[model samples]
Target: MGAGIAAAGLSAVNWEKMLQIAASWIISPVLGGIIAAGFLWFIKVKIIYRDNKITAAKTWVPVLVGIMGGVFTSYLVLKGFKTLIKLNFSTALSVGFVAGVAIWLVMIPIVRGQAKGLENRNKSLKKLFSIPLIASAALLSFAHGANDVANAVGPLAAIVQATKSGDYGSAVTIPLWVMVIGAAGISFGLFLFGPKLIRVVGSQITKLNPMRAYCVALSAAVTVIVASWLGLPVSSTHIAVGAVFGVPKLIRVVGSQITKLNPMRAYCVALSAAVTVIVASWLGLPVSSTHIAVGAVFGVGFFREWDAVRRARRQRSEIVAPLAMPKEERRRRKLVRRSHVMTILAAWIITVPAAALLSAAIFWIIQLSMR
Candidate 1:
């Protein structure tokens, strides 16, 4: 899309295509929110709030395996390598099956852990989810670097080609170094600008335990898969923030939070984010990973708060004397920090127009200078 836009001015860019992209900006986040919230509801009713969390947790383990395997496998098959690993539809399915089996194997011990010496045994078993969450984040990060690297290098490559060929339409070879520059840019961004934003996403929205984090990450992947199927033009980042979670928050691509993720959280978030990105690319919506990621965290935060409210109501009804609860405990859960969410939303809204205006100013300067 950047290459096309660079080769041709805005008039040359298809308005219909632009409209589709615009529609996705709205639809992507909404869709992502719905999917994520629905999944959380399922978890609460079936696992967290269920009478048999042990069995429920065990049951969901295999289902999550299928989800992760299928999502990642589809991602690899669709995107693994334009020039490297290739998997046809059937082959991809096979790989997914194998991954599912492997995940199940790993999950067994965690699910089957001895219930002895443990209070809230089901809660304890949930910790095993952190392992995959970390692994997924790593994969997401790698893919993000790969996909976004192209974004960084694309204009450079196009410019180089145009300069050499003296024609936007001419075929030209892309230098590998261009890609390296993009990757370097991402690494630099992470190293330099990541810390401040990581804190915002990690803790500000909600109290994210590993389980919630996993849901956020996994939902991002699932939404991308869904967007692909529906042929929607959603932003990569919107799906991420709406679909993904605090994992993206950790990597500095999404929201701000204080501490960095442990190795596991980092891994899962990055991998899931990358997969979400590739899926978005395949769908032709090269939306901002940062925006999507932030939205996803917000969605999770919002959902958590809603869930808390619902739980409170339920508990209140069951309690003989609801008024006996402490004042602090009686306070409504602030699942999401409204100020941060507003700030992030405002930034996303302004980004494109801000860039356009800046570009126009630069163009005006150039015209005066050339005169």
Candidate 2:
């Protein structure tokens, strides 16, 4: 959520870049949905109904492997060898592409052999992808750390620079204390709140098996990579959490809320919020990052609720699926916990306003004292 809001702040800094990112975010999922559905159709036509189990697995495995290869290769190219080698961006991209293709080709033989004669090959498809999924998650964590550690370093860097040079725009030197504090603060935060955040994300927001978790992590990594390449500021944390709200909202927390979170549609939720707040900020509105994130979360969910109600109104519309599962059916299987939703919504409602008002009062008091 913190990351989401910070990314939103970039719109205030530069709406043109932010909106361009907004376009990418919008197109990515739409195109992805079309491509995925088409791929599924292709499999049904070319592989699945044909009953050639051996060929099905072999064909799909390479595609998945190649995608994974491309993702990690791109990540490594961007940041993997900066300390060891200082290749320029284009060189790094070339190296990464070659590495990805090599890996994809190498995996074909391995995955082909592994998929031989499983009774439930379809169900086990994700199982075949499991190792790669875990690898992607690991890569994502490293990529996230590489990118998101900047959230801590950025303000500190600028502050240190300003204190020394009396100019916010000066070149900055990172002090040891700043580095220690940033690392220690993150460590402490993870120790303290990490478990709960992990629990809420893994168990509540979405049902996370190894495969689904890979979806969240992989999507985040790819999104962040795109953001970086575009020079857009983003928070990996926000993107990950936002990605969860995209699709397959399942309850996994034992005894918390069996209620469902088909609460929000997968596409358009995260980017919509970011773009909205960004446009507002550009118009000189004083918006809070926390507010934008929480609002986006709720707004998306509520939109889903409304979609459930209105899904039957139009038959030929592409915007809202008229053929989507009926709202009542969705309500039973995918009910969102009212308490869980409201608690965050309530906090989002007040936190920013209260903080701003209190700070204003304190500053006024100090001014009077000086007078």
Candidate 3:
């Protein structure tokens, strides 16, 4: 959409915003996975692994529910209800805290009531999580609807507003019909097409009982909350899908794959990446810190390789001894992993064109339907 607008010589395309959204595509899912995995780990340690699983759940589930209530409330207030009221972070947090405590106090008896007759088995424990899981899933869907409906309708609204007013670069006013169309389309599509995807994400990827499913749902919601706090516009669908699937170790591109990173080398990469991004942003360049950081790591790795080769030659000239480093050690000493470089390059190469083609196809379909 941005590309099409730019091609038409419209000033509506915000390149910096596009770059930030692209960066979020990388950052958000990873954070979702990490948060989900961590939540799963916590549940395993605190509840699942305990001898008295029911007792453990009865003790902790209320607290978790309260936290979720708080986070969800804050997210809805700050992101979902933005037009109604503008809230500062401190005010939002305070509101969240009060809501959380209220939820905690209310849920204590409810959870206790639910858990009262349950057995100490894992199956019984799963039963305890069903309510929270269902609630979390509903909340997640609500958040997705709120965020993505705007995205779906925004361009259409802009085009309508622009065509009606003959101003292509003005603030867009979304009509009531546009909102209804976006909502109805999403609803019908999801109703007709969502089950297959639900099955795939809910079960095909991994077995999920209420307990595990709750963790994933809550993790996704919490991740979006954190991203909101950090002021990043992330895809809720991406976050939920990532929570259901797994997190990738893509950050290793700069931290490890390019070279062995000690504290000093890691610090250098971080500082250089930060400075490069700061400067680029100040200059209004759409530069990605991810790319800059990876390049810095490669630079450091190549310098280390050159230094090692030079030292090896100097040692050889001083004394013609047998190979000081074993062949295996020498092989291990290769700084950069070529496979990592190639894989990263291949992904970078395909990402833009693939996304553009998909966007074009969807836009075409929408245009045809409208006509």
Candidate 4:
């Protein structure tokens, strides 16, 4: 009689808890998206328009692709991992981390070459635009922090519920530390390794005016925010990359230098990255947004001779100055490059597992301590 009574109580508690978990899963992303969208809109109308610039036409195309792509990729990947591994959160986290590292190693060289080629082709923008770029980067970072952090925290919330109620359906307040760690890890990834990818996005995939880049960034942020508000999981990386490509295409369509535009190459890269994410997720590997974005940029860069053509147009004197560097300085530069490569590799390898391990360990310890 006592056992029957206890089981009935447990079931009742679990049912109530499920409602809470469902509510949270629905609300959190919406809140995150609202915040992202509001900030992006503010930047667009107040800052971007103040400069008398407009985003390229058909900008929505890439923004839509990114939103759809991110949502689809994330859903499929998460679902596949659960189906294949049947592992606990801890094991899955570690596995995902290893997979992310592997993807990074393969992507870096390709992205670097693309960045260099893009730089070679485009005349560097005047320094005046630096402030706008920095601001845009901050906006990108904020959107990333809001959305991606949710990805890290979502499982933790589930684990906490499982531990506390001995059920999977409870909702618990997310701790400050978890938020801090996720934000920090993402910031570290952006600050230390983001510049390379940024250069690729900013310079390599397409030459963007500050106004154009701002529009692209604004469009991506806005789209993500809207999706998030609707509880949609979207890819900020895809949106940003798409925005970058969209501008060049727009310029071409209006009978501007269409010959220089390479929509086929851009589309190919984007498709490959999407396919890669799907494959990786299916294999239960957690891939990085950074990696996918970088790979896409690299793919577009490798198939063209635009760089060689651009180099031919520059003054010969400018090319010779870099070669005149002192041997020691050149050696130092090489060392810096190698170190950057290694650091990026380490971050990629460690992120998923580290987050998972941290989450699991925290949950386990809390359970023990509470008991």
TM-score winner: 1
Model 1 lDDT tens row, 254-289: 443422232223223333343444455445553444
Instruction: Give the per-residue lDDT digits (tens) of candidate 2, residues 1-371.
Output: 22323334433344564444344433333332232223233333444345765577577646644665665565565555666767775776687678768877888888777776655444555455555555554544444454456555877787788888888563577788877776776667567655665445434532333333333344444544444444445432332333333212212231123222221121122222223222222222222222333333333334334444554344436565456666676665443456665544443334434544554566567768998
Clashes of each: 39, 2, 0, 0
Ranking by lDDT: 3, 1, 2, 4
Q: Lowest-scoring 10 consecutive residues by lDDT in candidate 1? A: 258-267
Highest lDDT against the true fold, candidate:
3
lDDT of 4 by residue, 1-371 (tens): 12222334344334453353334322322332232233233333443334322221112222323332343334323443555745654454455455545544543443333334232211222122333333433433444454556665666666666776777543466777777877787677567545554444444343334433433343333333333333433332322322433433322221112112122222222333333333323332223333433333332332223333334335444655433445664343321123323333354344434544554566567668988
**Model 4 error, position 69 (Å):** 26
TM-score (all chains, Cα) for each model: 0.75, 0.57, 0.63, 0.35
Deviation in Å, model 4, residue 274 alpha carbon:
20
* Model 1 RMSD vs true structure: 5.8
For each candidate in the order shown, give its overall lDDT on alpha carbons.
0.54, 0.45, 0.55, 0.37
